[model samples]
Target: MATGPAKDEKCCLVAVTLDKDTIGQGPPDVEHERRVAIYDLLEKNRFVLRDYADEGPYNLRLQIIDRKLVLAVDRQDGVPLITHILSLTPLRRIVRDYFLICESYYAAIRTAMPSQIEAIDVGRRGLHDEGSHLLIERLKGKIEVDFETARRLFTLISVLLWKGQGR
Candidate 1:
C-alpha cells in the first residue's frame, strides 16, 4: 500500500482487487499477474492503487491494510463487480456527493426487489460480511447490468477515488 500518515485517519481511501483466476483454482501465478496488471493500469491512469485483501472472489470482501482500506464485491465469474472508496480527512461534502453519484450508478443497475437492493446498499456501505452471499444470489437474475456499464462504472469510481471530484 502507499505509505502516508494520512492513511491513519478514519475511512481513508480503500481499494479492492479481484481477478479472473480467483473464480476457481486457475493458477496462483496467473492471479498474481492479473492483479499486477490491474495495479499497473490504475497507476498508469495516475491513481495510487493500494492492496487491501484476498477474499478469494467472495460475493463481498473488506480489508484494511497498510493504513489503506478496501470494500469490494465480486461477480459470479470472480471478476471485480464493484468497488467504492472513502478517505479519512478532507471530509469535504464533495466526497459525499461523489459517493452519492456513484451510488446512483450502482442503484441504476440494482434489482427491482427492495430487500435485495437494500442488501447491496449495505454491501457498499462496507458491510461486506453481512449479506454478501444473499446479495450475490439475489443479484444473479434480477440485475441486468451490461458489461459496458459495469466497466465504465468501475473506471469512473476508481478515478473518483484516486483523483477526487476534479472534472
Candidate 2:
C-alpha cells in the first residue's frame, strides 16, 4: 500500500498575494474570477518546495517583473525561502487562447442554449487543464503543486498578464 504524507507533514500555501500593479482590476467578471482563485487556493492546496520540503505551510506572492513571473515564497512566520522565476513567453499563447475561450463561455452563459453553454464550458475547462499542465511543467523541479493548485495559480498568472480592459 502506498502512503501519503502524515497530517502534520502536509505541505501547502497558507497565504497568497498577487502584485496589484501587474494584476490591476478589470472587468467585474475577471476580477471576481481572480478573487475566487485566491479564495479556493487558500481554502485548499498542496505546495511543497523541491529542496525545502519540510518547511511549509508557506506564503506566496506572485509578481510579474520585467515580463517574467516571479514566485516569491516564505515560511509561515515570514522567513524568506526560494524565489523561483519563470519566463512568461511559453505561457503567452495558451493564456491568450484561454482568455478568448473564457470570454466565449461567459457570453454563452447568458444567451446561448444549454448545449451550447456546455460545449463552451468543455472547451474552457480543457484550456484551463492545459494551462495547469504547462504551469506544472514550468515550475518543475522548483516548486511542486498538484493539478488543482496549478489551476488556481494559472488563474492568478493570467490575471497578472491581463492588459487592462484591452482583452
C-alpha TM-scores of all predictions: 0.21, 0.91
Candidate 1, residues 13-90, lDDT tens digits: the string is: 223343322223323433443355345433322111123223221233334323232446553235674564433232
| RMSD (Å) per prediction | 18.4, 5.2
Task: List ranges where model 2 is wrong by over 4 Å.
Answer: 1-10
Q: Candidate 2: worst 10 consecutive residues by lDDT?
A: 1-10
Query: What is the lDDT, from 0 to 100, of the residue 18 in candidate 2?
Result: 82
In candidate 1, position 1 carries an lDDT of 25
- Model 2 collision count: 0
User: Which pairs of residues clash in candidate 2, taking residues 3 or more apart in a chain or in different chains?
Assistant: none
Model 2, 71: alpha-carbon shift in Å? 0.4
Error of 2 at 6 (Å): 16
* Candidate 2 per-residue lDDT over residues 72-124, each given as its tens digit: 99887789988988998899889999989989988998899999999999999
| Candidate 2 TM-score, true structure as reference | 0.91
